[model samples]
Target: MSGGGPSRRVRADAERSTARILEAAEDVLAADPNAPLERIADAAGVARATVHRRFSSRTALLDALAAQLNERYVRALAETRVTTAPPLVALQRLTETVFNLKLSHRFAVQLDAAVTPEVLAGLDLLFARLRDAGVITALDPVWCRRVYLALLHEAHDLPADSPVLTALSAGSEVEARINLLVDTVIGALGGTDTTNGLLVRSVRTSASDDRT
Candidate 1:
């Protein structure tokens, strides 16, 4: 007469194994976009049988990966210390974090194609928070999520040798690009001027300092 639940330790171990699998999958997929489950299992130091037992199929694995990514995004949004930051600043941070994660974890490629309805629901929850916080304008949450996904897809497609990606690998250029893009998008939504004076000024200052 047991309750319908696994023991706590068993549950914990299962969760831990799942996390490891997801981490390994992200690494393998980043290196090779079409990484197989056996390869992911090998990278995670687990058996192929175990990987199949856990994920059941490629689609299941991708669905789990999408859930994991959305969970990470939600956690980042919760922990971000943006109480006093302007809407644009918060949006910039959110976009940069998402872009970086997508670039680093190739699981993002599958997100757009195989994301489950549950994952979209989770994203809607996060988007509600962003909307409540005024981080984005009052647009349809579904549309906003689609737009975010599109931007991430574009960022993920950037070649590793591209100047933007190179700068992202090197320093704060990714953050700068996120800020520029966010400001531009927000300005368009708000019907305001989108020419960013601060960026132009910073570029000029850097050039002037270089000459000295």
Candidate 2:
């Protein structure tokens, strides 16, 4: 005589526990890839048995971590308007959003997760559009995508104490790095910096027009 579903409160508690465990795992494992579940549970403020209940094994936890990050990446693409915005604007915004994600999950990103081709399908389409529009050089979209991703990984590998970060206050450090990343990506893919200048002008004009 019961609806065959868990109570709403039970579902809410499960969701919170899962989120906490994932966040803690990302931080703990990043600091020590060899970190045990006990440590992660401590970081998450949960019982050690709870971690096991949530993820059957280390491998399972790692897979979940990868899946969570992929979901976040897809969300990032949508939130940044990658599919619908102007190519230049979309590319820059996507790059900025991904830069933060990669850095935030630096260790988890290095794991050999089963990331599907569909996870990157949106980016591939965007790159093709940019190439066709002459926004980028005559390189193949696939190559461009590879170059862009490699650059992002390199940026993620940069140490927190690197001179580039150390030279600026915390508030400005991320901005400076992202600016450098965007410029370098455009240059590497045979796009001109002048287009960026144009993008800036267009954005300002669009904002002004919107207010009228």
Candidate 3:
């Protein structure tokens, strides 16, 4: 038992190192998918050997990170309690959670685009709820949903240090930022009176979609 403290410390440090590597991978890979492992190591403040010890190859690292991200996104949904909240509150909470998820881990956003049918079903419920509440516009649900996904993907193009993102990260009024985007979307959608018959649809994910 005398050696246990040192061992525990070593283990904790290793875990911290691994976490840093994964975070660095997300940030670096999000900007340039082809960024070298050396960049990630530098970002993590760890030796390249440490990263290699945790993930033998770049692909292996991404795959593991994807799994980690999926778990986190699921957790965020649960923590946000979106479904149980009131319509505006639920939308606000979901927007905050999703934008934060994307901001923190771009790779996770890429991985999540390969969404399962169950997730699409959840979106369907959310869209219907918002429709019932007359919050969303009267546009085609499928079209609206596609726009929503597009917005998420497109936002990644913003520089990591963009003033908009800086304010988003530091803002005391979280809803204000989300409201800007949401208001733009709602304005684009117009009124429910203009709604077409097009209902929500499934999200198809080709295996190669993540490569982009």
> Which model scores highest in TM-score?
2
Count clashing residue pairs per candidate: 0, 0, 0
Worst 10 residues of 2 by lDDT: 195-204
lDDT (C-alpha, whole model) for all candidates: 0.62, 0.74, 0.62
Displacement of the residue 44 alpha carbon in candidate 2, Å: 1.2
Per-residue alpha-carbon lDDT of model 2 for 68-184, expressed as tens digits? 888887788787666676676677677767778777886678865624576578788788888877887846777888887888777656776787545533245565555555566
- lDDT for each residue of candidate 1 in 76-195, tens digit (9 for 90 to 100): 565442343333344445566666766666655466643556556655555555576664565676876676666655655655566644433224556545544554454433323335
TM-score ranking, high to low? 2, 3, 1
Model 1, residue 127: what's the lDDT? 56
Off by over 4 Å in 2: 1-6, 159-171, 194-212
Taking every candidate in turn, the Cα RMSD to the unseen true structure, in Å, is 7.9, 3.9, 10.5
Q: Pick the candidate with the highest lDDT.
A: 2
Question: What local lDDT score does residue 181 receive in model 3, on the 0 to 100 scale?
Answer: 47
Per-residue lDDT, model 3, residue 85, is 47
Candidate 1 root-mean-square deviation in Å = 7.9
Question: Which candidate model has the greater TM-score, 1 or 3?
Answer: 3
